[model samples]
Target: MLLKKERLNDILTDMAKQARVYVPVSPDANDGGGVGKSGKAKMTRFELYSPGTAPNFDLVNTTMPPKDMLFPQTQKMYRYGFDTEGNAYIDIIHDSDEVVIFGMRSCDARSIECMDDVFLSMGYDDEFYKQRREKLATVAIGCASVAETCFCDSMGLDPNAAPGADVQLSPGVDGQSYVVVAQSEKGQALVASWQPYLEDSTAETTQVSCALKVNGDGLKDKLEQMFDHPIWEQLSKKCLTCGTCTYVCPTCHCFDISQENKMKDGERFRCWDSCMFSAYSEMAGNHNPRPTKMPRVRQRFMHKLCFFEDRYGKTLCVGCGRCVEKCPVALDITMLIDDIQAADLSKAEEVA
Candidate 1:
């Protein structure tokens, strides 16, 4: 099926009636005035669709990943207060809403899959995350152009396809249309609902290639052996411990839980946290496992390359390159991968 670019607004309008439809709107295009925490223009974070919302389909990737749609940066778990008899009471906050995220790229879609493995798999299931995940549907768009920092292909992701997406929108043979393919029951229902907006047409999809490439073959194995390598010392020398990479990373799911109180009333919430921060691993007695930037930096990369793979059989990084593009310092992960590939494992083994 082909959905004409001109009729995108109509389609969004129709979808919005049943669910909250989110489209990729640039901050400049959004006069609605809700900037993200990064303080930069919310370049590509999915925003609620309005008639005036202008989605930038030409953009290679969004400045921030679409993880916020499922796992919010700050979520209130429950509210607590005391009764007149001094008995404590709790009110569970249920804020899940049906949502449709449109225009997500292949890498970002895969990031959601990574999140699912953590939130829904194993013997545990997070009720908060599961509620939102159950009600959300994704419509991923294939990339027609690649960013200089993007390395999704190197991370075992296809630039032109997202197998995990509910609905896949391929770049059409022409620039004004998208080839739609529904991959799930929900996606098929969505397609059926959008029948008025779609046309039956066959078109060839455009293939996209990333400019950046990293050899991730045996990367996890190599990282497992290079835990105490001196390469981390050199890499951590220039690091500012800014935590920008983890914040922008799609699959970095570290968070801290806390409570806010006013007199007797309080609310417990969870907010995103980064391993690069000095306080991230700090203990109550002031005993920090990763005291310096060296171990902290090593832990961050090792988690992305090794620990996650060890547990989930998949790398934590989706390689959308938001970290590569937004880092204040030139701490490139691609360079780290290259260095690891070229590192003397014999010497690392001897040191270990």
Candidate 2:
């Protein structure tokens, strides 16, 4: 089924009636048509859709990943307070709302799959994450074009495909229509619901390819032996340890849990944390396992490349290249992959 670009708003309006709809909007959409206070262009992020909300399908990928929709940056776990009789009470907070995330890219859709492995698999299920996951339905938009930094193809992903999405939207031959394919029961139902807005048209679908490329072959095995290599020392030198990469990454899921209390009333919450931060691996007595930037930087890359592959049988990175584009310094992961492939392994014993 094909949907015309002119009728997208009508389709979205109807979908909103069934579930809370989120669509990608230009970060500057709310910036009053000017640069932000920092004098930099705002990065696109997903926002709740309204009648006039314009979804930015032209963007390659949003700087802010859609992870927050399911796993919020700051989530209140529970509330604690004392009764009149001085007895303490705790109220668990588990809020779930049915929602549809429209206009997600293939990489972002894959990121959600990575998150599912962590939260839903391996004999453990996070109720907090599970609730939101169950209530959410994803509709991924295939890429019509890619950014210069995007290398999803090198990561074994097709820029124009999202196998994990409930519904997939590919650009039609006309470039003004979308061929919608429903992959799940929920998605089929959604399509059925949007029948009024859809047109019966056959159009050729074009597959987009990423411009950037990297060799990830044997990279994981090489990383297993290159833990102590001088490459990390050289790479970590320019790192600012700002954790911007992890924050922007679609799959970096590290978090810290803490509580806020004032006058006998308190709430336990979890916030996003980065391994690059010194305190992330710090112990009770101020003993830190990863005490230096070199090891921290090495850990971040190794986890994305080697450790995660060993555990999940897939790399943690989806290769959306938000880090590559957003990194203040030229810390490109694709470049690092090439460097790793070119590095001599005979000196590994000496580094060890």
Among these predicted structures, which one has the highest TM-score? 2
Error of 2 at 270 (Å): 0.4
Candidate 1, residues 223-340: lDDT per residue as tens digits? 9889988899999999999988998899999999999999999999999999999999999999999999999999999999999999999999888999988889989999999999
Clashing pairs in 1: none
Summing lDDT over every window of 10 consecutive residues in candidate 2, give the lowest-scoring window: 29-38
Candidate 2 clashing pairs?
none
**Which residue runs does candidate 1 get wrong by more than 4 Å?**
31-42
Q: How many backbone clashes does candidate 1 have?
A: 0
TM-score, every prediction:
0.96, 0.96
Instruction: Judge candidate 1 against the unseen true structure and give its global Cα lDDT, from 0 to 1.
Output: 0.90
Model 2, 231-306: lDDT tens digits are: 9999999999988999999999999999999998999999999999999999999999999999999999999999
Model 2 misplaced stretches (Cα beyond 4 Å): 36-41
